[model samples]
Target: MTSLDLALIQDAYAKLRPVVHQTPLFSNRLLSQLTDCDLYLKAENLQITGSFKIRGALNKVSAVAQTNASGVVTGSSGNHGQAVAWAARFMHLTAQIVVPTTAPAAKVEAALSYGAQVEYCGTTSHERLERAQQIAKDTGMTFVPPYDDPLVMAGQGTIGLEILEQRPDVQTVLIPIGGGGLISGIATAIKSLRPDIRVIGVEPLGAPKAYQSRQAHARITLPSTDTIADGLKSLALGTQTYPIIERLVDDLVTVDDDEIRYAMGLLLTRQKLLTEPSGAATTAYALRRPAQIRGQKVVALISGGNIDVPTLCHQLNP
Candidate 1:
């Protein structure tokens, strides 16, 4: 698969350091022991606004600095919306975020806090995207898709730049799957530099597009979706992300909702990292498939930490 050029990603890292946090790359001895590999955690959960969504969101918003974005429009139920809204505010631009009614109020409030005008719609994320597209077209606003753009992918690729430097011996990387932004970005950059470093993306079986898409040899927009991994509830991989995954991603593993909850519990008890279900996907994958990771130095990209409190309380029953 064609991967991103490392120099380009490095340049993006240079551009982003001021706004983006260089979240820690800490070794998780317990996780490593579970996976039978040398495992490190990419604490992207500690990033600004608690998610890596900012990297791509900022890159896209900043790219439009010349246009001055009359208004920016995008569809998201969570992190992406907040990221876009935050980036828009940073650029002194107006942002119009479309979300489904099912999205958490905390996320919507966070977006509004950053000065984005919020619109809510139907039950499903797909319905929200449809509304967002119409809003962009009707208003002459730029529609920023969460994972469909090359520029955004390149921006997200900054994670790969960090990975290579922090752990050169990393033989494997497990990243959470959403619209496929995080994995696509990291795979594009890391595989280019260290072709031997296998990139295994983890998706919740509750939201299984990445795994299904890989098996089909094409992007499969699932007819319907359900999962506690709110960040990964997208129905399909973006066109931009699909091609990259087919080329660069080494494998895609899926874990069910219960497994995800178990992983989250493990993270809290074992690593002292408070992660949302989606963020724990890679770790769950590693635990389940330890044989695949045995003897290798691995990293699980803990993508974000923004779990809704009530949701966590219910899921964990603590």
Candidate 2:
């Protein structure tokens, strides 16, 4: 297994600087007042492809582009598929993305618009991943493990580097967790640089893979998941991401769908930011427990803004 370290993350940063956006880290007075903390928002929702997943996708695809592989295949709930498709297009390689049958239509369409072949599999990350791997084998394409590869984690870690640069005084960093790639990468970067900073991961209550895994002290898969955050319904954390998160992440917490909905509405109405439920999860955690991080300098990472209009209206109205 390849080790994930600060040096590897830094190298990813250097390589991705020309491509990925250094997303903004801005503070909102209203959110700070609500959480009773000095809060900054890492707006990866405004990132290219409308999420931070592009960072990892570009980095991973670029590496694969150097090889003789004809193309790449992978599975995603939504955002990762779009990112991979976009990255594959940018790198001049073909892509085949296996998405869950229940994945958000907008995200699926976005992937298709990028000229990648799209396949619908069972409505779970594991199921789609199995199908994607089989496709890779049959097509002689490289299988890019969505969140499990070292390169993907290192690429995502570039967000940590940006956060530290954007806010050197940040005391706590809250990131939404899916297969643990985002948190694992950012936590490793933050802990390696400023060990004092707290790195917390927020997951949907219905899909608390990271939280449950931490409790068990080992990686475990859930039989099913239920959440509005389609991008966050992974049944398990990546094998490569789990150990890094276990060692470096400070804590893991979960928020119910209603809370995530509330946070999404608040972000749009008050903060003037549109985020999908998965993106607002960290904010939901902070809003639900203001006293926990009171008086601390907190950075809540908004992971994506790819919700469809119908879902957005329903969530906002609910």
Candidate 3:
């Protein structure tokens, strides 16, 4: 329905095979009992780049590979920084990644280790993008947008493609939304495949652009947000992704930091899964409002595993 199609995603899967790991899926019996749903966890946190962002990063970079340019540039909250840096390295290209001032030191270090030049910008993700774009234009770099690119969304769609095929009767697919790349791509593929399936997007209550956009039935902007889930703190929804979501996504939900922390603790204690706050948004929603999504064959994406190790260790055994 958008610029990207299944063929493009298929090609991306082929290109990504060498670089990205096919993350595993596992049955969550405790989650099932708690939420009264046949819940499956798509362990994207265990993905090769430690998040689903690598899929979009590789697809976007490969789309520009034929241009044979000097380098590419992008801005991110954290996960996308690592993804772009990893992709740039794999493709043998230079990457200039811009991050907001609040981005975690651990994430920035990972990007640097991947050999990308990292820059710190304003306090918000939108401001970082503005800086990144200007640098790309001034330096003749290919501007690799985090979520506003068709290629990026298509790559993220592959997650939905695999989920539907793996769990044929999946009734709901819940994904966390920051800039909307992952949810848009996933909603596009899954809704196209099975119109009856529900596509739910989770956002942090403090960072509610996606929820606002859905409410307005048009693109809505966010001023700023302060949330512990730094990865979900985008000031606006993605441009290219908004259309896909307007057409495909069935519903949206939100969770607060306390809920996220509770979900993270539950996963650590009950499931032994180490998830960042953003990745645990779906579980938070499920736990907070079980009756709404209960008793469904649901697929929830644990979108990243790049937690602060010491922070997680303290939470786990505290």
Candidate 4:
């Protein structure tokens, strides 16, 4: 397992504070009434690059830039790609991002706008990895993994720190899971500091890799992911993130596409938050499965706000 401790996370927080936005955490009255709990939204959709991926990407790039690397390479469904491209630009380093062909256009354009070379791979995590690895090998660029690194996880743990400082009385945190980096980091930080605070993970039912992995006691690669939450469509969990999540996270739950769209619509209309489907999964779980965390001060992480206009219109109207 990776050596992730409180000190390492604190260092990441200190390093990232100047670079990343300390995103807002606010309680929504409408959502609170609906969930019958004191509900707070960690609006990371408002974060730099429109997602929390910046934290980890920035952390990784900073470390790699120290060695004066020729360039940086990474793979993502979208948000992480944008984040890496953004961070690389900020550091004045060349970046090449490999994304699945099915990735959202808005996200792809966002990365391209950062002056990074964007390449299309197949529509799976493994395919993205293969292309990214090949690019890294050919160009002799530093490969920045989207997740599965201690430094990256430590950077993401900063979110947990901010949440606790923002609301010391928070009873529970509902974090969205992709490849498990965000939840693993948050859960580790929360469980280490305030052991009383519960950390729950939310995943789309169509891409329940982490949930299935936990059930089987090993990683389970899905043949395909069939969810509207595109950012959470990892085929399997990383070795580092999986063990940390299994040990630190208190619970795991899933939301369907319908529930995700409902939550997304609610956030957009009621809370005036433009959250992507993956980010909205936590609130979806809260609304669909209330028994698990009712009557608690809950904070749901909004992972990103990169949904396309057409998709948003369809989700909101459908």
Per-residue CA lDDT of candidate 3, range 1-318, in tens?
448666767777677777677777778678788767888888898886678999999888876777898888998888898998898888889999999887777788899999999989988877889999999989998988888877898888889878977889888888999989889888877777788999899999999998999889988888778777888888888778888888888888889888888888887778777888888998888876456577788888999978787766654455
**For this target, which candidate reaches the highest lDDT against the unseen true structure?**
2
Tens digit of per-residue lDDT, candidate 1, span 1-318 = 423456666777888988798889988777777778788899888888778889988888887766865878899977889999999889878899998888877778889999999988886667888898999899988888787776677778998888888888888999999888788889989887889998998898878898898889878998888888888988899877888888999888889888888889888888888888888888888887566788888888898888777877787874
Model 4: number of backbone collisions:
0
- Candidate 4 segments exceeding 4 Å error: none
Q: Write the per-residue lDDT of candidate 4 for residues 160-233, one digit (tens) a residue.
A: 99999999999989998899888878887888899999988889999999888878988788888899899999
Clashing pairs in 4: none
Off by over 4 Å in 2: none
Ten-residue stretch with the least lDDT total in model 2: 285-294
Error of 4 at 56 (Å): 0.3
Model 3 stretches astray by more than 4 angstroms: 313-318
Local distance difference test, each candidate? 0.84, 0.91, 0.84, 0.90
lDDT of 3 at 168: 93
* Model 3 / residue 294 / CA error / Å: 1.6
What are the per-model C-alpha RMSD values against the true structure? 2.1, 0.9, 1.9, 1.1
In terms of lDDT, the poorest run of 10 residues in model 1 is: 1-10
lDDT of 4 at 135: 88
TM-scores for candidates 1 onward, in order: 0.95, 0.98, 0.95, 0.98
Give per-candidate clash totals.
Answer: 1, 0, 1, 0
